[model samples]
Target: MNTNKTELNDQELSRYSRQILMPEIDYAGQLTLAQSHAVIFGLGGLGSPASLYLAAAGIGKLTLVDFDEVDDSNLQRQIVHREANIGQAKVASAKSNLAQLNRHIEIETIARHMDEKEVNELVRQADVVLDCTDNFASRFALNRACYAEKKPLISGAAIRWEGQLSTYDFRNEDSPCYQCLYPEDNGQELTCSQNGVLSPVVGMVGSMQAIEVVKALLKLPTLTGKLMIIDAYSMMIRTLNLKKDPGCKHCAR
Candidate 1:
C-alpha cells in the first residue's frame, strides 16, 4: 500500500458517496482505500462476500487466490460463483463477478495452489491479507506469511451456525498472530462441508471481514488484538481479547 494520496474522480466520488459521508471515512479515508491493495486467499463462502464488499468499496487492487473449481454444491454458500460457473476455477469465477461489481478496480486471479514461498511473496505485495481459507493448514500458512511480511490479516470462519472473526495486524508490535490463538493444528479442523452451515452465517462473517479491511486501510481502530465470536443460533456476539504468545514460533522474536 502506497501512503501517497489518491484523488477520486467524479464518477468514483459518486459511486462511493455513501461511504465517504461517514465521518470516520471521509474523502481522505476513501482516498487511502483507493490506493490500497488486498490479497484474499480463498474464493468460497468467506472470500465471496469479502471480495465483493472490498471491490464495491473501491479498493484499488485485489488478488484472489484459490485452486478449487466451482461446484454445484458451492452455489449454496459461495455466492460469488453462479450456476454457470460450476466448472470454472473459483478464482476465475470470483474475478469475473468482482469485475462486474467494480470495473474501476484491478482484479488479479491466481487459480492454482500456492506454496509457502509464493504465499509470502504475495503477502509482501499486499497492504493487507484476508485469510478466508477453510482448513487449518491454509490458515497456519497464511499466518506465517503475514507475520513475516508484517501485514495485517483479517481471518474469518463459519460452520454450523457459529462464526468467528479476528484481525491479526502484524504491523502492530503487540498484535497477536493467528497461531497465538490456535497454537496447534490437531488435524481435527471442521468445515462447512462436514458440518452444516447456514448461508447467512458466512455472509455475516465475510461482511465483517470487509469492514475490518477498510478500517485497517484507513488506520482506524480494528479488531487487531481481539476476536469476535458469533453464535447465530443464540443471536449472541462476544469479544475476546487476544494476547501475543511470548513463546509462539510464528511471531516470537
Candidate 2:
C-alpha cells in the first residue's frame, strides 16, 4: 500500500494552523490548496491582492502573467511593485514580491500578452485561471482559453467604487462561462485608465477573487454558479445566479 502523503512540516503547520482549525478546510483542505497550481493574468489592481493571498495560502505553483512596467500611479493599487522597482517589468517585480512573502511556492512569469494558441497551452497546465486584466480584449481572450480548457475561472473587474466577481467552470453543466454573460466585446469603451478605480476597491475585490480560487481548487462549495456584485461605497454585496446564454457565441459551439 502506498500510504505516502504530502505532509507539511512543523514550520508549515505553524504557518497554516488557523486555516486548518476550520472544520471545512481542515488539514486535508489546506494540503489540497498548497498543492494546487493557478495562473493569474495582469498583475495589476485585482491581480495584486489575488496573487498575494494565493501565494500566502501556500499554493504550490503560481504563474504571474503580465507585460507592463511599474509606474508612479500604480502604487495605490499595484501592491506587488515597489517604487524602487519602477523601471522593471511587472512580472519580475511581482515575482520578487511573492518570493518575499512565501519562498515555498514556485513562480513563473511571462512578460507578454498571449493569443489563443499560447493561452490554451498555459490554461491546460493550470489548475485554475484568473482574469485580472484591465481591458476587455484580454478578458475575452482569457475567457475563451479557460472555457476551452475547462478550468475553473475566477475573474474580477473594478472601476470607480464598484467591483464584480464571477466564476466559470461549467462542471455542473449549466453555469455561464464568462462569454455566456458577456457575449460581445465592443471595441470603443471606457477602460480602467480612463474611468479610474479606487485603490482599496480593487484590493477588496481581488482578495475575494483569491478566496474563490481557493474554494475552486479544494472542490468546496462556492458561488461558481453566480456573479457577485459589490458596491464598495455602500459596503453592499449581491449575488445573482447566472445562466448559460444559449446564443452565447463563444460557448454555444
- How well is each residue in 31-83 modelled by candidate 1, as lDDT tens digits? 88989999999999999999999999999999999999999989888998899
TM-score of 1: 0.97
Quality of model 1 by C-alpha lDDT: 0.92
Q: Could you tell me every candidate's TM-score relative to the true structure?
A: 0.97, 0.95
Residue pairs in candidate 2 whose N, alpha carbon or C atoms collide under 3 angstroms: none
Measured by TM-score, the strongest candidate is 1
After TM-score superposition, the amount by which residue 135's alpha carbon in candidate 1 deviates from its true location, in angstroms, is 0.7
Alpha-carbon shift of residue 140 in model 2 (angstroms): 1.2
Off by over 4 Å in 1: 2-5, 185-187
Output the TM-score of candidate 2. Answer: 0.95
